[model samples]
Target: DDSLRRFVTFEPRANVAMSVNLLVEPTRSDADAGFIVLQADRAHPMSGSNCICVVTALLESGRVPMSEPETVVRLDTPAGLIVARAACRNGQ
Candidate 1:
């Protein structure tokens, strides 16, 4: 959308060309969260970096509970459901 493009464009640090807009929302009981990746011109495919970033953000921000040793994060993306295993230690 033009609004989204304008929003990202105004961010000095965010490169409008390479920047992607991630729409995160609540999902079914099976998944932790759902996301849709939007690029400047079109909707992009699933991105590994974006997945990692979302997972990390969810865990770090306390949106998803963090468990020591390992935590399973189920992400609902446009491509499909992604199961991410995150290694956690000392609440990190």
Candidate 2:
């Protein structure tokens, strides 16, 4: 049961069948959003794969969409999108 709760699997590679894990949370209300971008290493999961280095987020609020991460603006990759690691937890 805890194992199921310990991982958020997502493929970093578009074709090689690999995944990565990252964690993020809002520190306060009225926050835009945040991320836990892990540095790539030989021991990382998303490593050794064809990483486009891009990720997207799908945000939802309890009541209104305004209180969620609505807009996405990537500023770090070839496509101008920062790479996203997978979320290894629930309630994302």
Candidate 3:
């Protein structure tokens, strides 16, 4: 989907929204998810908000398994690991 990358833009040099990451398959053994961060200028390791978006996308989109109460998502970023617990109700 690199071709679709053009649709997204980073501007004003904001710390939080200056970059974004795309989730991919894990490249390591200890990771449940893998991601690559793309900045306005260059690519980076990770972003906290981007990680949140990724985990949410995975669960909400049914890419990751879900449970009635909670579901744990262990992500592997280029920088390190991210563990997220998502609360679910009515498949949300």
Per TM-score, the best of the predicted structures is 1
lDDT of 2 by residue, 26-85 (tens): 343433333333332212333223332323333323211222223332222222234233
lDDT of 1 by residue, 1-92 (tens): 36775566445745555656475774666889887666555566588888888888889999999999999999888788889999999988
| Number of the candidate with higher lDDT, 2 or 3 | 3
Instruction: Look at candidate 1 and give me any clashing residue pairs.
Output: none
Candidate that scores best on lDDT? 1
* Model 1: residue 10 alpha-carbon error in angstroms: 6.4
User: Compared with the true structure, what per-residue lDDT tens digits does model 3 show for residues 1-92?
Assistant: 55334345433333445566667899778777798877666667777788878888888888888987988988888787878888889988
The lDDT of model 2 is 0.31
Give all TM-scores, in the order shown: 0.78, 0.25, 0.72
Question: What's the CA error at residue 23 for candidate 2, in Å?
Answer: 3.6
Whole-model lDDT for model 3 versus the true structure?
A: 0.75
Deviating ranges (above 4 Å) for candidate 1: 9-13
Residue pairs with backbone overlap in model 3:
none
